[model samples]
Target: MAGYRPAVLVGRWGEEAQLQEERVRDFMRRRERGELLIQKIKSLQESLLQKTELSVCKDGCVHFGDTVLLLNPAPAEPGPGACGSLALAVPLEDSSAYSAAPLRAPCGVSAVQGVDPVGRNTFHVLSVDGTAVDEPIRFGQKFGLGTTGGFSAQMFYLASDHKSFLRFATKSHLQQVFLTEERSYLTCWKAAFWDPQLRLEHEGFPVPANSKIIITHCHTNRSLAVPRNFWTRSYFGKEYEVVCHTYLDSHKAEEDKNCWEIVTGDPSNRDGSMCDRPDPQPGGVRKELCEEA
Candidate 1:
């Protein structure tokens, strides 16, 4: 009643019945509008929650705006001690698992588990929306690429949770790569699709959907990697160890630990059908995924 103003009747003083009718008509109109607004909101929620198609991935092409899954192509390198392949995922906060470091391992360590690709592995690939560039991610692009004092012209992704972002930290002797509910400059990264065997450089420039690639932290220069030999147990069971470190002297095959295959879409959808190796364009077939440190 404080801010509410009753409808003013424009007619005569003895028109009490007419005034009552006008008030009822006004109330009905307000109720009708409110119901219409609610219906529109419900329709929108249904569309987003049960999407039929991803706007950026209709053709399964790796577009900038697509949400994706980063999967290690598995023992991309086969050593006697390799753990084969695994998908990187964040642990649930309420789950009963913590990083059990070696007896001498440092304190305050954070651990992320490598398991099969699932809902916990979803990420949104994003670039500046109002930029001059288009969305399809391309090869030969720099990842975690920036000068010490330069502005970051990089790409990054967010966890499906919306509030979280992937972060690379060197706050300790070990390079700590963890998922933070907060996003910052360190959340930035880039994609590389240069497979030595498949020929990285002729014109396979635009990264096709489902291609094996390397994602590097924008500020750390370390690729997201999983070590099959470094195993651990979680509430879910035995899982591989995931980290972000670039081996300075790694050989061609040894570097496969850094290789990840991007499967497009929300993890809830469980769709990786877009993953297919791009036919290396017919020209310069470079058989290396990295450069010398």
Candidate 2:
């Protein structure tokens, strides 16, 4: 039987300072107050865990439990690349530890650092004395104790029902893209590359309508991508030869007219996908594009 190796990983990121300290005090106070406080904490935990979902995964990735998988290189050559699997587990969760009580949900003390639903996955919070044991929750035993403190609780997760899968396109790669903008939303990556250039050649990409493409020079960490075209101004345009324009300049709010135009060569075409549309001197800085590295 394929068995699962017990691994633990923490997901505490972007937590504030004061809140962390306060949560620590709360846990310590409860622990010192004996059974009454402990029971209260357990009740709270139960309520939350009942509302939260759990999941599990066999794939060795940076999952809630598994930190990362170590891949080994093959000797000289073989099959595709060369590989094996090494399982790694990191610290579960961290927070301000108090002398009175061990912080249970320390990682969830803040708005940003709290426990988040990783969609649908099997996740179980097992009671750890020294090793991993899968015991059912009951009265007496410290089995599946939830971190939230509802009754005696344990942490657990399950694979999400909304699983994501990958798909390959029939085309070899992507080159030129089409963008459309409307009143409420925007669009990007409407079209795929028919013929790619030297830079975009063989570069395959997911054609999510209005896919954002990051354009950058050599340095800088800013990124900018045009949204897909829809109905802008009174004019219907293909792709913005430029970006960042006010919609009020064209026509009436409900007027269905194509007021502005930005034309450029299709890069995948035997021609260059360079923007040849007239400069936006009279319109706006809708063209000279820049993005993050």
Taking the tens digit of each residue's C-alpha lDDT, what string does model 2 give over 76-160? 2233522221111111222111222323321211111112221111123333233233222211122111232222234321100
* Candidate 2 error regions (>4 Å): 1-29, 32-90, 93-202, 207-293
Best by TM-score: 1
Lowest summed lDDT across 10 adjacent residues in model 1 is found at 99-108
What is the lDDT, from 0 to 100, of the residue 77 in candidate 2?
28
- Candidate 1 Cα errors over 4 Å, as ranges: 1-60, 76-82, 93-117, 129-134, 140-173, 196-204, 248-254, 265-293
Candidate 1 contains a number of clashing pairs equal to 7
Error of 2 at 177 (Å): 33
Model 1: how far is 172 from its true place, Å? Answer: 11
Computed on alpha carbons, the lDDT of every model, listed in order, comes to 0.47, 0.23
lDDT of 1 at 180: 36
Question: How does model 2 score by TM-score?
Answer: 0.14
